[model samples]
Target: MSGPVRSATTPSNPTDASDPPTSLNPILRGFNPDPTICVVLASGGTPTIFFLSTSTFEYFPGCAIYTSTDLLNRELIGHALKRRSQIELRTVKPGADSWASTLRYRPDEGRWYLANCLFQRYRPASDQRIFPRGFYVFTDNIWDDNAWSDPVYFGDPGFDQDLFWDDDGKVYLSTTTRLSDRAPDSTQKDLAIHISQMNICTGRTLTPPVVIRRSPHGIAEGSHIIGRNRIYHLFTAGGGTEAGHQGPDAPAMLLRRQTSFFQSLEVTMEFSTQQRGA
Candidate 1:
């Protein structure tokens, strides 16, 4: 880190306090930093990994997908579902079709999904103003070359989506609320997560948006569910990067765990951290 070196891991509440020592490094921490992943159970009960990647260019901020077998290692699969396509930067303006990214996965339905937070502009025919909205996308196979389903709008004007699903066939999605006229220099707005039902079969969003969590420090949104038997756990990040100190507010990747009938963030902590920038 370039700034004052600051680092921590679930400081107050240590989940696995009694666990013994081990030497296995994190299997999947390559070019991707914040990962929202899902394990696809293939035929004969095999699990595959698929995740979302962020913007690589100016007008091509599309979500890239990847696949991994060993969990720690992976390969860039292809583009996220079509709904999250890049916004065309046509005008003399710098950016064309830019795309923001969001994601979720459904194993029972054998599909992986993503949402387009990639916001761009458009002047409607009647001179009506409308900021581009977010949408959803899905695929059948995670590891192999698969195609994304049609895009479906999930938010009015939003991006940065967080999603999760449980063992009992329950589904949830959390996302940031998009404010049309956010202050330019007012700093980054807090990221939000919304909960809803996702149809496991057709790969469709099935419920109204429900607010789960919001943070001014910005939400990393790479959420995963971990627990055994009856005990349930939710892992999330909370912290910002060091480079964006004075420019755009870089919030910490806040980590939080949840349980209790889909209510309560129960536990708040960190999994990985970067207190400063090099």
Candidate 2:
């Protein structure tokens, strides 16, 4: 369930008792996690931000959306999927219906896109948990709940999938996967991040998935991609989510590709102490 809307801005002077309380904090509360935001500037140059968060086994009306004009105050716009055809949770276990998701606006297509991994319950008979499947849906109108298209399932790339639409009109999908068995790979054989060219209309990959980054600290997930000033940046979280147990490895890591959108990416920076959540 969602919480009351609150302001994100805070006052500069907290010591002054006479100063009015200007900060409300937390634009969203309650079980809301793994938020992805997309910003668009209107014709008048006013900034409009759209936010989507994981619902994770919650009942129908999954993945709520919030919008804000100034980034301080956010209003509950609506949900992207509202029908049983869009999302079915009858067979999913608690807290496994949906994982980390991303919201992206494609200017070329004039539509908004949302990509996420759907988790299924473990089968006791087979003693195995079903691999999470990644899917995406788009809507011409982001403000309407009924505008979202049916889920178009893609290959099970990994958890926390994200979509990156580059200026060259090519689309890419990034997700966590196991280290490739091919040559020139990481010593850590278990986990890595992968990216591939994706067809926005059919949710199909056109190229073989390439390993962009390998986890140095035993684990890595939660991939997000953005392009700015001819540079593409990828943000990911590793070393687990817990605080003290993470040891020396950072919670968040950054990788960059300046030459092209889908070329080799090198880790440029890392936040050792930052507590990044999926």
The total of clashing pairs for model 2 equals 0
The Cα local distance difference test for each model comes to 0.47, 0.70
Candidate 1 off by > 4 Å: 1-34, 41-61, 81-105, 121-132, 142-146, 155-157, 167-170, 178-191, 196-210, 216-262, 268-278
What would the TM-scores of all predictions be? 0.55, 0.81
lDDT of 1 by residue, 63-104 (tens): 556665544345665655332232343342333233335455
Q: What TM-score, to 2 decimals, does candidate 1 have?
A: 0.55
lDDT of 2 by residue, 42-126 (tens): 7566455655555545556778787766666667777777787877877877667777788887666678888876677633454
Clashes of each: 34, 0
What lDDT would candidate 2 get against the real structure?
Answer: 0.70
